[model samples]
Target: MNILILANQDLASNLALNLLLPSLQRHTLRVFLSSRVGKPGALPELKRLRFFEQSLCNEMLFPHLPEPGQRDAQYLSFSQFTPLLTSPVEIVNTINSDESLSRVSALKPDLILSIRYGGILKDPLLAIPKQGVINLHSGLLPDYRGVMATFWAMLNGEREIGTTCHFIEDDSIDTGGVISACRLTVHSERSYLWHVLQLYTGGCELLLDAVERIAYGEKPVARPQSTKGGYFSFPQAEDFTAFSQKGLKLVDEEEMLEFFKHYYY
Candidate 1:
């Protein structure tokens, strides 16, 4: 099977891909990493989130990322793993552009998988893959939808957070038929980033199972979202203040460093 993966260029997405790609050795794979940049005149909160994520990536991930054309390292991060892939990884700014459309059409993908991809895919690109597109969302559907779902869930004081694997049938963000979902206990002691990163472990497993089912000619069951779920945009300053009041940190540097040891070591 020819599979095309669309994901954001960040530590969490990289971690998910690292866990997923190894199990997909039987299929042909191509990856497109999104820059995840917002439009000009974006809100301060959005800018802050972007800055925070970029800072973490720069400090913790970029230093260890393999350089262009440099492949053989004792330990391989997602970027380093590219040299061993059947297709060269692409860093895309406009996923719906004519050039991107043409490139995807050329691949003749059997399926398209999306994980934390920043851009919204249109009909032209969505129509290319025979098996259609499946997305791994960090939050459960019909409840939490949109950006920074884990943060939103934690802010709402939810007892458990979940990851949803669903079919992206249209341009509507995360309002798709549920293929599968897995939940994790919300640990109050953990930072929002920790919960966000942990969600992908189960997220990748669900994605792998969905892909295998589709590849084996079995139709994966997709349950329609029965309720109209609320959508969450980036949290504002007040929301952050409330979160902090509840004793939650946006990030725990020490915990993150410890988590990265698994990939780096």
Candidate 2:
């Protein structure tokens, strides 16, 4: 299977590629990474990813950090990173113009997997693949929809936080057909990174499962999502304080412990 991946350079997206790269060794897999320039936040996962683009100042890769020992580059926009980073097997760069689309079209991809690419897919782009495009969203669909679902899940004090792997459809957000879903506990004190990591892992597993099923010639089922539940971005600072005092009722200790170990240590 020829796989084409679209993602930004951040820990979550990079870690996802780390997992995805090994699994996709059996087939011809090419990755296209896009930079999210002008976006202010933690450095995107794309920075850590190595590709074949002209060396754009290694300093740009390691932006100023608030604290010593931490690399603090702002996040890369989907448009910025798509055309800069490319490798022999993976084309990493920012997609600045329509010409990039032609390059993608020429790949003749069997599957196009998107994680944190942060862009919407349109017709001809979606039609390029035989199996169509798939996204491993960080949030569960219907129950937790919209941007930063895992962060919202943590802020909301939800007992379960997970990932949703689904087929891309006509909607702008996560209103697509569910291929498979997985959930895990969210302990109290688990930071944004913790829940997102869980979501990443679960989403990856579900995606691999979907891929294998597709490889075996099974048409994966797609389920319509319920419209009753939906969510948005992470909680504000006040919201976090308020949740600590009133809104958030619970947290998971084991998960929090793991989160601290991985993130803090």
**Residue-by-residue lDDT tens digits, candidate 2, 25-75:** 676766675654223333222222122111221233324223323523333
List the candidate 2 regions with Cα displacement exceeding 4 Å: 37-97, 234-265
For each candidate in turn, the TM-score is 0.90, 0.71
* TM-score of predicted structure 2: 0.71
Off by over 4 Å in 1: 37-52, 58-60, 63-75
For each candidate, what is the lDDT? 0.83, 0.63
**Of the candidates shown, which would achieve the greatest lDDT relative to the real structure?**
1
Query: With candidate 1 superimposed using the best TM-score fit, by how many Å does residue 197's alpha carbon deviate from the native?
Result: 0.6
